[model samples]
Structure formats: C-alpha cells, structure tokens
Target: MTRHPTEHPQFYLTAPAACPYLEGKQERKVFTHLIGKHAPTLNDVLTHGGFRRSQNIAYRPACEDCRACVSVRVCVAEFKWTKSLKRQWKLGQDILGARLPTSPSSEQYDLFKSYLATRHENGGMTDMSVLDYAMMIEDTHVDTMVLEYRSKGPDSFITGIGQGPLLGVALTDQLCDGLSMVYSFYDPDFDGIGLGTYMILDHIVRAQKLGLPYVYLGYWVDGSPKMTYKVRFKPQEHLGPDGWAKVD
Candidate 1:
C-alpha cells in the first residue's frame, strides 16, 4: 500500500465559521497538531506551503470557493526601505528587543492581557486567562522564539533584564527559508510611534542578518482595512495559485 508523507500529521478541519475579514462569508481551516520529533521540520515545510502556526496547531484557510486570504513573505535581500519606514526605524531606536526561548512568564502575560483588553477586546482571545496565555507561549512543538521588546538600557545586562514596562511581544517561528511571524502585540499607548510597523521592519533586518531569505507576514486580505498594513511592506511576495508571486 502506498503511504503519503503527511499521513502521520493527524489533520482535521475546523467547522465553518463566519469570516472575520470578509462580509457575508464563511471560513474553514485544515489543521494538525505540530508535535513530536518531526514537528520542527514539518512546520518549516508547511509554512513555506502557506500554513500558519498558532501554538501547537498549524492551520490554513480552507473555505470553499474563497481565495481572498493570501500568505505574504518579504524578500529581505531585495527589500527597499521607504522614507517613512526609515523614520519608523529611528522612532524605535530607543526600544531594545531580546529573542529568547519559548517560555511563559507573568510579566509577558500582563502585557499580553493589557494589549488584548485594549486592542482585541471583542476578538476570540479577549477572554483568555493567564493559563490560556501560558499555553499559548509554551505549547509550541517547533523552533519558535519569543521576542520581548522593552526600553533600551545603558548596559547589555540591564537590557537583558528589560527595564521599564514591556512595550511589545512577537511570537515567531524560524524556518529554513526565513522567519514566520506567528503573532505580535504591543502597548496601544505606543501606537502613535508605529511600534507595529517598526516590529516588522526589525524582523526584516533580523532576517537579513540571520542570512535568511524571507519574513513571512501571515495572511493579507485585499479589501480588509485591518489587514491593509501588511501590504505596505514593499517588495513582498504573495502566495497564489501560480506559486509565490511578487507584488510591486
């Protein structure tokens, strides 16, 4: 009997639900638990093929007859920083970011709770408890890391301890080709300084320094104003039926 390589993935499809990005639409997802020894390698391959990791489950939109959501990745080597992007870079200069292993902490959770309460109060994760938050950070089965953003300090050791209040957090996955930004949140009070954009910009620079090719930015829905910002990162490639196509 012939066996498929993915036979061991234990895939499942989510029940149809109302689409958050598009009006009068429904959405479904094909997902699987990314655990066990092969999880890291499988996740890398899966993400390159358009899957996104959320905690331990890797999922992709599987809504019938709908193709509005497209996966995006920035070509770090080819990216050109716009004038506005440069300004954002300077704005975030006072911020120090530390990439650490996938572990949970009350300090991080406090910032996460505040961010959700302020920005995603009506979203699915709004009701998540501290336990839920811990699981979200520590349940990963792949090569994932959490980047903690804080105010820069006078010394590296002080920076490692991260002085001042937590400013932002990014859950990221390192793949063979690039880094996939699983999720990110920040202090809404810092919104005016463009922390969100600056995070992505920093990821691009991080990717370049890591000798990686791309920085996967998850999905981009064409008409969704909420997701429009993902498109502003120029020289990005959108995954389509024909394969990865560059969007100028």
Candidate 2:
C-alpha cells in the first residue's frame, strides 16, 4: 500500500516582489499553512527554524541573493535594560497590557486604521479593511493571543486587565519555551512615553514572570531603520546557519 505523509505540510514559494526593506532588490517567501491539532507543535518547530507566523501561515524569506532578514529573540533571563530603556519603561508605567480574546472591535479597527495611515501609508497592510483585520485575529490555529494595552485601572492588579483608551496591541504566540511576537501596533500620536518600546519591555517582563526564556522579536533586517529597535533589547540571539547565537 502507498501512503502520503498527511502530517507533513507542503510549502510553496511566492513570486519575487519588491523588497520593502531594501531598494533595488526583490524578495520571495516560502510558506506553509498551520492547521489542525498539530498546529501549535508545528508553529514551535518552524519558529525555531527561523520562520515567522502570520495568522494561520508560517513563512520565511527565501530571497535568491539577499540574506538580510535575520530572526531575533531576546534572552529574557539575561536581559539587561540600558538607562534609556529603563526611562522609557518608567515613563509608560501607567499603561498595562492584558491578554484578551481574538475578538475584533470597532475601537481596535479605528486605531489600526490610524496606525496604518500614519506609520505604514504605502505598506502592504495599508489597504486592510475591518474584515481583513478580523481575519488576521481570528484565523489562527496555534496558541495565539491578543495583548491589548491601555491605561491601568484601580483594579488592574487584581484583574490583570486594563481600562481606558487602547494604546497598543500585540498579537503573540505562546511557544513551549518562549513567546513569539507575531505583530504589534501602537498609537503613533502618543508622545514622550515611548509606547512602542514600552510594549516590548512589558513583553520581556511578562516572559520573565512566566518563566519563559526567550521573547521572539521577529525578523530584523540589516540597514532597516525601523528594525533597529529590536536590537536595543540587548543580550539577544540572531538565528544563523550555526543556529541561535548571541549577537549583542
């Protein structure tokens, strides 16, 4: 009898497209669907192999020439914040993040629209509609969550939830050994508190409290100014041919 390996997923590659992080370059991606009961396990394995999760798909850059997209994960146990990072954390103490269900809301959609308009005007997600946003949140099969950040309420310590206008949101995945940050967006108009930096710092603290050793920060592209912030959370490992190794 002949049998096919249904447990193993098939991967497909996309046609080359303009590289978002670099000019005069093209990029392609190899991707597979994560589905069924084995999704969480599959996600963990693929993540450690330098692939990133998006909704229900796992993908990694497969450029023919450029090798600039490097996966990064912070060593949470050994993470040490610089004075600047500390300041940013302290300034944003009023904000709290709580893991909420993947249900989409009008408020979230409004903020998401504003963020895309201001921060990613010409980017791929610029045209995302509310239904698309809903799909992004609800289409996942792995162990995923939506961490919504807002002003801490009087009962925040007891409830582990926040109140007030939403400030930031991170779509994260809980892996066996770490938390993989799938994607994050924040209020671009909010000033002084460093909302972007605070969300990451909070994730590290959450990982530490949960006894997770790493906080995956997604791909870090060399020469991408936007990606430079990922390196600031020092004592991080970059995935390379030799596997994960300290780069900072």
Candidate 3:
C-alpha cells in the first residue's frame, strides 16, 4: 500500500525467521521505515503501539501462534528500586555515565567487538564490522542518543573520556513519550558489576528527570532467562491485544 507523505508510517511483514528468544519457534515482524520529515512523530506513535526501532526500521513481533514477546515499559513515576537494585547501583557507583549525541566512535566499536566475541559469539550480529556498528548508531533518521558509561576522571567539566576500556554503552532513542533502549552492551570482563541492570536503573531516573513517564525495556519473552531481568522493574506496563496492561 502506498502511503502519503502526510500519513502515518506504513508497515510491512517480514519473512519467517528463527525465534531468538524461544527454543523451537519461528518469528516474524511487522515493520516500517521511520524516515522523512515525519520520522520523529512517526516513531512516537509506533513506539506507543508497541514497535521498536533499529536504525530507521520500526518493527514488532507478528508471530502466528506465539504471543510471548511482550512490549514492556517501566512506569518511571511509580518505580521503586528493590534492595538488590540499590546494591547494583552501589556496585557501579564509581562508573560515570554520560549521554551524548548518537555518533559512533572507534572505542565503541572495539568494545562492541569484544562484547560480541565473548557473549554473543554465535549470534546473528557477531560478524558486524565497524562500519555496520557505525551505521547502527549514526544512520538513524529520528532522534537518538548514546549513553557511555565509564570510570570518571578527576576534572568534572573537563574530564577525559573514559580511558583504559569501555565499561558499558546504551543506544537509546528519544521519543515524544519516553526513552526507548534500542540496544546496549558492556565489557564482559566487568561481569560482576551488573552494568546491564545498573544501566536500566539509570535510564529510569533519566526518564523521570526528562518528565517522561515510561522507559521502554523492549520485549519480555516468557520462559526466556535472558529476558526475565526486564520484569524486575516494578509497576511496568505490558502491551497486549487489548492494550497496555499493568504488570506486577
């Protein structure tokens, strides 16, 4: 279907692919290009409707039998940290995180390579090169940002870029309603730091400060240990066939 320039973004279906979260299921996506003059506005609407952005593509699960992929957003206003989350913050207390424009850097690529090698060696994105990484961060047509986490320097204002190695990174999209976590990675060497959990905590705070009510945590697939972490943030909402419903 041809969509007018003034119309909302139009979507298309993807061919079946192996489900990344589930063991023996196939997955498909309903996607659209979020570009042109209406990208920012289109992005907001799509996100509210449970779509996720990767570069300029906005997609959501379109599986035939499984509805396991649930879009979740933390209600920043009502989010209360668990004792462990507080301790996770303390564990990563020394790491300084700064949000900057979505521009790619070699340091990011290096760390990304290391992370993929160690954690996702057999994953689909394992072979992505620096140019691919660059595109992932910089090719966006809508509002996006990169949050870099590292060890802080002595000078606050003139602090040097985090040196030695990259600790963590968050690829986030700034929507009209909230911050969508497009992707994130951390130095696997710092496994004990719980940087993944800490980053989510930080984003919740950031969302509240921005006066945004939600922080999109992407999909939470039931029975997937990798996705179970997303449910820890309380007072979150999940998108269902009926609509966004409050989850425990």
Best by lDDT: 2
TM-score of each: 0.94, 0.96, 0.94
Model 3, span 1-248: residue lDDT tens: 87666366567999999998788999999999988878888889889999999888989999999999999999999998889888998887677778888889998998998888987887889989888999999988888889999876666347635544579899999888889999999988886678889999989888999999999999999988879889899999999889999987
Given candidate 3, what's the lDDT at residue 198?
90
> Clash number for model 3?
0
lDDT of 2 by residue, 1-248 (tens): 64433268899999999999998999999999998878889999999999999888899999999999999999999999899999999998888899998888888888899999998999999989989999998999888889999999999999998899989999999999999999889999998888888999989999999999999999999988978888899899999989999977
Sorted by TM-score (best first), the order is: 2, 3, 1
Give the alpha-carbon lDDT of every model. 0.88, 0.91, 0.88
The parts of candidate 2 lying over 4 Å away from their true place are: 1-6
Best by TM-score: 2
Scored against the true structure, residue 228 in model 3 reaches a CA lDDT of 83
lDDT of 1 by residue, 99-124 (tens): 98888888888888888888778788
By summed lDDT, the worst window of 10 consecutive residues in model 1 runs over 154-163
Residue 154 local lDDT, model 2? 97
Q: Which portions of model 3 miss their true places by more than 4 Å? A: 1-8, 157-164
User: What local lDDT does model 2 show for residue 90?
Assistant: 91
